[model samples]
Target: MFLRLSPRHGSRLLTRIYSAVAARRCPSCSAPLPTALPTCPSCSHIEPLPSTLSYHDIFGLPSVPNPFCVNTQTLKARFLQAQKICHPDAWSGKGKKEHDIAAAQSALLNKAYQTLLSPLQRANYILAQQGLSESETDRLGDTELIMEVMEAREELEEATSGEAVELARQRNRDRINRTQKILEKLIGERRWDDAKKAAVELKYWETIENAVKDLE
Candidate 1:
């Protein structure tokens, strides 16, 4: 079991035994798996593992927060350090057991890094904590705003000069920044349903992010 908790007795147990059940390596060369799996660095073999594994356990964090905010850069650094240790390069000339361990660790690291990175992604993480999965596509009540974002993307994509795209980019950036403030306030109030409602709108802001990239 990944986690076993008993709050009344204050008893708990967590296991880091992913290496045992998962075959994380190149079948031919026995090369350890990399974070971006299906492509082994050592032997260039494709080996993809199932996603059922927990990202939290992959990085060795308490399943829930306690004096640890999700945005803590220190925790992020620790995660990166864990990934470094598990990188296949560290297992040079190691035995099969060692190689497998390294591969499992690397895969966990990649998944963990991806989980903790973005605010929307973080919202989904919080949703998972609540036994909910945030919708992959957000629905907004403001169809006009949605259409606006769509048009902006098309315009930005076709813009001939950086200045033209920059104008659209800045406008969308301001909108996203404003929406982010709303998101933070809702989360602070623990108004998740409202936060999720806003998140659907915020998904449109992601289009703005894409617009920014197009400008660049």
Candidate 2:
């Protein structure tokens, strides 16, 4: 007979398995790293273990296409922790190689945080990870979407009053929301072609939104 474990027990089992499979150790002093801590306690080393960890891994997020459900508070906290560890100033007394590594890691962490912070950017990052290219994304062939964006821009350009402009802005925001849902569905299905097209269409709507803001 198979025994089902409780949630707490399952979580503990997963943690133990992860620890055994991918435990991090300090490169400086070869000490095991505590959860989410940046430095080695034994040697006071400020650098993290050297590994090709993805952005999701760096942020302790699930490796999924839609990171929209990520908690903003948790993301901010993790980003601050990582920055504190990888900041160049923290490595001032270290050697040149270590300092350089710290700077590079800090830059990467910043990029990851910024990318995942914005829904559109996170979608684009997911597409890129799936081997989609800018040129492919730019070559959007959805005639209906193209016409809709054109009409929206024309509406924005012809608006004469603040109310009209606000209405246009609201319409664009609605379009963004709709397109984001489509993108999310496509990504969930691993439909890279359709997802890229949706992402490009969303970019156009975003540009329209910004233009409306300028008019306001």
Candidate 3:
């Protein structure tokens, strides 16, 4: 069964887990590290992996919906806190070990922000997390729906001749809304099988959106 986590609780758990893993000693020499350091400066020994990291820790979030459901204000505060602690500038004039750790952590945090902020990417990330990737069977089943989107896309693609361009653009926008509604319904119903089908059709709608932009 898939376990669900509230964004607030999940973020706190991830932060605590990462902070604990970040607090460690050099494995080889048994020397303690500074509280701020994620790795030992002297031995260059790596620590065990943390249980959780940011959403971008692995390209995006797992199958959890509401990827941006985390309290925006709280997330902003936590991001600033992370920057203060893990920003590479803090390690200036420090040894390579500290610098590298700071840089790596900073990069991960930035990635998390980017992935969580984007809706489409977040959806793809969630699906991947569920071990439910885009598949051929999903595509085939949704072909009729996809064909509708594909036809619209082709119309937009071929609209360069006249005022048809404007008509195509408006149609594309309308489809975008309709496609979103379908996907939302499928996900809300936890119909993964159908969700995948909707996802495939949405991809075609997205393609039409992109293609129509060229007409403008």
Evaluate model 2: give its lDDT: 0.74
Q: What is the C-alpha local distance difference test score of each model?
A: 0.60, 0.74, 0.59
Model 2 agreement with the true structure over 84-107: per-residue lDDT tens digits: 767889887888877887788788
The sequence of per-residue lDDT tens digits that candidate 3 reaches over residues 16-130 is: 5555543545457767655323445566543333435446332222334544233445545656655665667866667787678668877776766655554445455556655
lDDT of 1 by residue, 1-216 (tens): 545457522221212334332334556687665432333556644333434444554444444432113554755876776566557777756666667867776766676677665666666666555566676564776778668767867877776887977887787787777777787777667777777776666677776677578557
Cα lDDT over the full model 1:
0.60
Which residue pairs overlap in candidate 3's backbone?
none
Evaluated against the true structure, the overall lDDT of model 3 is 0.59
TM-score of each: 0.60, 0.77, 0.59
- Candidate 1 error regions (>4 Å): 1-76, 143-160
Best first by TM-score, ranked: 2, 1, 3
Number of the top candidate by TM-score?
2
Error of 1 at 95 (Å): 2.5
The positional error of residue 75 in candidate 2, measured at the CA in angstroms, is 2.0
